[model samples]
Target: MFTRMNGIVCLTMALLLGCVASIATADEALDKAFEALKTYKWGQDRATLGAIDAAVVASHKDDAAKKDLEAKLVAVLKSDAPQAAKDFVCRKLSLIGSAASVPALAALLPDEKLSHMGRYALERMPCDEAVAAMRDGMGKVKGLVKVGVINSLGVRRDAASTAALVGLLEDSDPQIAGAAAAALGAIGSPDAAKALGAYQAKAPKELKLAAADAYLACAERLLADGKANEAKMIYMTLAKPDQPKHVRLAATRGLLAAAGQK
Candidate 1:
């Protein structure tokens, strides 16, 4: 009995030591991977990033580990790393990021080259900070970069952005104005619908059609939210004869939907 117990003890000790060694190896791999990621570029072997990827997968069930990884990624974003490296880090953060990742991601939003990927991560983060970051970025970027931020806000359907977006409807750049209209439509709030309605009359001919479509989109959203009366009113407006044929058709369908008719 004594000999058998000794053998079991030895086996247990060996397994424990093996586990410790494995953990040490994984930690070392993670460290090396981060170091390599600092200068990582496209077309190079992806094995370095692969290490971090595996760590992310393994951390799915471990919230603490995930947060630690997120911190590391945020650091990479703040580093003087190549844009390629930051881009890779953003993709990872999109998977495991939290509010902690917001500041780093937000800092990239005004950068024309980095804004898209930055938005890519912020868009997935379900936090008020992420929305605020994009909103703040709106004031700092212009042209297509600003438009991209506006589109991200729209995708989030952030109701808080409604007022700002409504103001953007009059931007000197038609493209910016048009994107704002589309975003407000996606938001689909009563405020958004109201804003679209107000913009329609003054909208340029080229923009009239877009504004009408956006109005229709807002009405659909209202109907979905059980605001049938409000939806019917918008549908009725678009059902007018002066509206485009397609717009009138869509309005008619919306009117029927509001009435609970087939």
Candidate 2:
């Protein structure tokens, strides 16, 4: 019995040592990858990043490793690394990043070259901080950068951005206005529905049809959420003869669905 117990103890110690050695090897690999990342460029050998990618995959079930990887990625974002390196890091962060990564990612939102990658990470963060970062980014960016942030906010279904988005509906740039309308529709809140309804009359000729479609989208979401009366109100408005035949047809279908009909 003494010999058997001694053997079991030896096996346990061997397993522990093996795990420790594996962890040490992974750490060394990550160190080498990060060193290579500093000078990484678009057409460079991607094998340099393979270690980091492997670390990310291994992090899935290991929260400590995930957080460690995220911290390292965030550090890279704060560095002066090439855009290719930053872009790769942001992509990895999108998968395992937590709120801790919010500030670093947010800092890149106004950078024309990096904004989209930053948003790519923030969009999947699933935290209020990420949403706030995008919202704050809206005021600092312009043109297409601003549009990307607006789109990310909508993708998040952030009702908090509805008021800001409503204001954007009147932006002088039709693309901005159109994107805001679509985002509000994607949000599909009561406030979004109301705002879209009011915008219909004032919508520029170029945007009139887009606004109507957004309103329809809002109504569809409302109906799905058990807000049938509100949905019906929007459908009835779009069903008016003055609206286009296609809009009317969609509204008619919405009306039927709202009424719980087959």
The residue-by-residue lDDT of candidate 1 on 1-262, one tens digit each, is 5798899999999999999999999999999999999999988788877889999889988999999999999999998999899999999988888899999999999888899999999999888899999988888899998999999998999898898899999999988899899999899989998999899887888899989988998998989999998899899989999898999999999999999932
Query: How well does candidate 1 score on lDDT at residue 67?
Result: 92
User: TM-scores, in order shown?
Assistant: 0.96, 0.92
Model 1: residues with Cα > 4 Å off, grouped in runs = none
Give the CA lDDT, 0 to 100, for residue 33 in model 1.
95
- How many collisions between residues are there in candidate 2? 0
The whole-model C-alpha lDDT of candidate 2 against the native structure comes to 0.93
**Tens digit of per-residue lDDT, candidate 2, span 198-242:** 999989999989999999999989988889999999999999998
Global local distance difference test of model 1? 0.91
Best-fitting candidate, scored by TM-score: 1
lDDT of each: 0.91, 0.93
